[model samples]
Target: MTRLIKYAFLMSAAIALTACNETLEDIAPKAERQLPSRVVQTMKAKGMSKTSPVMMRIFKEEGKLEVWKAKQNGRYDVIASYDICKWSGQLGPKFTEGDRQAPEGFYTVRPGQMNPKSSYYLAFNIGFPNAYDQANGRTGKHLMVHGACSSAGCYSMTDEQISEIYAFARDSFKGGQREFQVQAFPFRMTAENMARYRNDPNYDFWKMLKVGYDHFELTKVPPKVDVCGKRYVFNSEPANGGKFSPAASCPPMSQPESLLTAYKQHQAKYDFAFNAALKKQSSSKQSETIAGHSEARLVADWSKRRARGEKVSRLPPNIPSPTAVAEAPEAAPTPAVAATASAYTAEPASRLQTALEAVAGEQQEETTTAATETPAAGTVPSPAPRPNTSPERTASVPAPEAGSQGTSLRRRIQNLFSR
Candidate 1:
């Protein structure tokens, strides 16, 4: 009976051990459910589609939008290009939201403005007049990319194309921009990116802005913006479509300064450059001519160009090589003095004379010291000084003024006393 009890205990202990092992196994991820361990596996899961993604590229130079078909692993082929808006006002930063002006900063394309059947034609909301604007105390609303060649302050793509673009963005968002990069730039920020402008009474504000622009320039990521004291702290976090909120400390936009002012400032420069280019083109027959001058001749030339189907643009000439540019020859180094010159020989003799003089002076000083030590000529030595001759204390003496005789007298006295 005791043996039977022992066997039963052994069996119970074995079963408990097995149960613990099974519990651990259950907690571990199953081999089938594990995330793919390789990039290829992830790629396979995210299937590639042949259908081109709709993309919009805004050219600030022409104030137009270039609709593109961004095929996977393919170049962005232009479907159509259309002038959407003109520079409405000044070129300054949008200080507050709801300024009724389009923003120049890089913003992500998001959902919320995809409408197929709208009265003003097909449109997509730019998600503008955003919270930043409202927080900054800006007013205005309903900024959309709509149809009709008119705008209060919105990009108006053609009615037919906007629908296609909208559909494409919707689908692509569902897909991804790794297949496309739909981007928009403002008033050709390229050259204007360099053009000069005065510190908009809000120079400091723009400096803060430059922080955000610099980040975007480097990372190509829209900066996470934070606002304090009506100034922007760009790249503060919430740097993309994520579950992040603007900081609670963000102050309200009491600044009456128009965000459009930044645009207006920027526009002046762009308009200047653009108009200058236009004027140059109009005035100069030096512009490239394909065997024609008159408007009729140009039209005929254009028709010939169309027949040949050659693309034409008034692009600037290629920059010249460094070698092509003339540079002044470097001046020869000032001629070095010849070692055989008398100046060099005299230099050593003078140095030797100085050394000999120094030695002679030292000898003379020694002789004078000896003379003082031995006692003045013809003077008898005083009776042998007392053995314990301690000097009497004197009242404190002020230091001698700089370069005073007191200093020289002190040195002479010290020498005599030493002697």
Candidate 2:
């Protein structure tokens, strides 16, 4: 009976082992499976590896780069966020080349900026003096990010560290996202950062760039840089290869026609509104003097126009002579009986009339109030005088004139309105 029981136990154990192998088949790795061809094509276009979708982010100041993807509910599930084994310089806007400062702007990674054989693990350069930079007279070059724990102005990730970042970028870019923007800010572009170094030596330049940078952070697209001179000029459109493309080196020449086109369009809208309002005002009366009733009516009409977002082409053509609106006249009850007329003194009735007339020009009120407000920071108020109606000033805000290679904002506005 004992021998039979031992034989029975051994058979039962063998049967249990075979059943476990079948149940674990789903967890086993597939050695022969391959990625679909469509995925392969996309990976090639975005310069990604064949294994996964690219999804990554980098914060240079914090020395962290992360990879993540969305969960079923659309929240990000981080695959990784790691500390840099090596990095260089404090975070700030790199102005001149070789300032040993990491740039604070939007950038991307390209195959060219990347070096597979870089002594560090992998590497790429943050190309500065981009088209936008050149238009603003920003000069800089050769800002790089690399691997193997080494840095000058570049970010160095260990070979293993960057592999994850590279994989994420490659996969994300390949997944139908044309361009991924990398925002590198000085620690953070917080109110604290601005206050801490409001008087730093580089404050002015940083502040100026901050305007454009903030706009980009908010809008994701670059702000229109308005360089003013005889002719307003602008930088070229951002190139596709992040910071390191040859496209950065050969910024497209500014085409006056294109810029003028945009200006003309904006102007046409303004002109239409101005003409309509002027016609309405003219129809009120042909008299040189305006009445109090007419003044109140005009203000109501202007309020309506403002509600609709219409800009006045010009300030109510400076009242050649200003006037005040007439006040309600008081009257006494009819005289009960005819009384002897009393002698009346004839004071300077004309002077009183002149003063009363000055009160009737309602349009002047808005102009007077606007004049008293403080000018925006960094802007010098233009001398008070007849509003500048010069065709150039009236047509568009004047900006720096572009050389053969630069485009001017003024030109764009002109072109837009002219059309």
Candidate 3:
């Protein structure tokens, strides 16, 4: 009986230990059941295996997630590219909590970071607030790439897409890769695009990101990433086998001479092309401004006349009826139109339209107020003039008599037209 009890206790303890040691996939089994056949086929096509190493790259602007797998030839080949269903925030790195900005940087995901029982289907944390982020004093948490097609500040893909991406990471981990890298970028770091946004506040940061981007582009290998001097440095070694510290001054470092030469040549070629593209973009913009100037002046004159209650020959054709404009299918931009469009499309047009509408609304409101307040013709009374409530209009319209709210409103409308 004593021997029997001891054996039973030992068995129970062994079982418990094994259960505790079970992996995420072992416990969840979803990836095991659904991913094996597809993963095997994909690996076979890529000349890889289930255990092959993997890396991911995400482009928020283009909404793409690409997975690359190591092949027998020791080169990484793109195994799959998934369309991101949705991602939150604008074209910059997340700075603080609740910023809703999906992070843009190099991250590493380890086995423990995988969440098989995620509310957003299977998910993996992208390891935000990395060394570079930390060095810069940026803060955020729980940034993930997951399924659900919705996000606050995460990269959300369809359930099917996440399944495959999750499987790739899982297999890589099982194949003895302890971690995989994820490179997130605002957009493709193309020279033409960079040149167009050169004046933007984020240009310097984007330029930094392009260093890593260029490294990968040149070598087709994942760059060795480290942080020093509060910025990311890639593919460099300390001058004499020294260790790197993220927040400290960068020690003298060296890169392969061949790589240095290749990078310089690449930069020279792109710089020339970028300058050419910039000249074209600038010339196009100047022509557009010149063409629009006359129309803008006409619109301003019309707005002033309408504000004064003067009869106008016609309204601007571009100023569509609110309902018609709302219902109209936006005309598909032709190639010519697209070529001339701003790098950030439709922004200038949208802003101008919004300002115009606001001015028109204010003028209408003032006109109604004036008509209601006009006293009986015979009554002579002086009331102190109302101040112009709209300060934005003051720039274009001269101040009228104290009580001339209608004139003030009209002036504001004219100002918007000028804009």
Candidate 4:
């Protein structure tokens, strides 16, 4: 009886831990463990090993997550590009807990970070709040690139995507790779994008990130990341042979002169392109502003035409001037009010009497037409525009005044033509 009890206890423990790892029937590990045929074929074609080291890069604005694998030459090549299903927050780094921000920086992912039986299908923490983030006093936790297409301060992907990505990491580990790198950015660090975003509040931080970006572009290898004096310094080691401290002053360091020379050449070309991009953008904004003002002026004329029940522009214009409706031969309330007023204000006293007569005729015509109309069922007819009474202001067809009266008159007389 004592021996049986011990066997039962051991069996219970196995069942309890089953979900954390594979079951007995899962020993083959082919479908779940091996890379897919296409990917394997790609590896062979690219001269990469079956289980080489992997690196990942993310672009939040572009919603792309790229997996890169090391080739035999110690350089990296693109293996896969997955579309991120969701990532929260704007184009900036996380500031505190619950900011819902997917962080941006260089991060390391060790073996312990992988989660196979995740509630989100599978996941791995991207290791946010790295040395630089810490030195700057940023805070957050459990930022992951996970499946289930759900994101809350995490980078999320579909279940299928995470499965493949997880396979890459797993196989790399099986081949004795210890850790991988993740470089996250707001967008592709292009010269044009840099020029466009030069004035953003986060530009200084992004400039720091570009050092690593430039390194990879030059060498096709992930840069060695270290933080010192609250900044990221790539591929440089302290001459004094001390470990880097996130918050301490950087020691004297040695750097590769060849890499520096390549970077300088790259920067010079980038500078030229960036300046050209800025000029193009500046010119674009000026043209839009000019067009916007012209469009604004079109609205006034369009409103005027609608009030008088005349056909105007189908849309606002690049220029505002006398509308076709204003020049149309006839509408109940003709633009004669504006025209007559303009003529009277400029001509002699004899013309004032004639202009007043034209204005009176126009007002009478509008009033008579409105009074004769019948409103639809379940509706009362609009009250007719009042008849001209005072000679000093015989009729006031509100000419774009600023109050509610202006609002009522400037808006179109709906269904006026059908009436």
Off by over 4 Å in 3: 1-28, 34-39, 294-419
Model 2, position 364, has a per-residue lDDT of: 46
Q: Which tens-of-lDDT digit does each residue in 41-138 have in candidate 1?
A: 43334442323455565654467776555434543445556666443434443444445455543333555456655666666666554545555565
User: lDDT tens digits, residues 43-85, model 3?
Assistant: 7987998788999999988899999989988778888888999
**Per-residue lDDT for 33 in model 2?**
24
Better of 3 and 4 by TM-score: 4
TM-score for candidate 2 = 0.36
Query: Model 1, 228: alpha-carbon shift in Å?
Result: 5.6
- Top candidate by TM-score: 4
Error of 1 at 141 (Å): 1.1
On TM-score, the stronger of 1 and 3 is: 3
lDDT score, candidate 3, position 218: 87
Q: Which model scores highest in lDDT? A: 3
lDDT at 168, model 3: 90
TM-score of each: 0.36, 0.36, 0.65, 0.67
Off by over 4 Å in 4: 1-31, 294-419
How accurate locally is residue 181 in candidate 1, as Cα lDDT from 0 to 100? Answer: 34
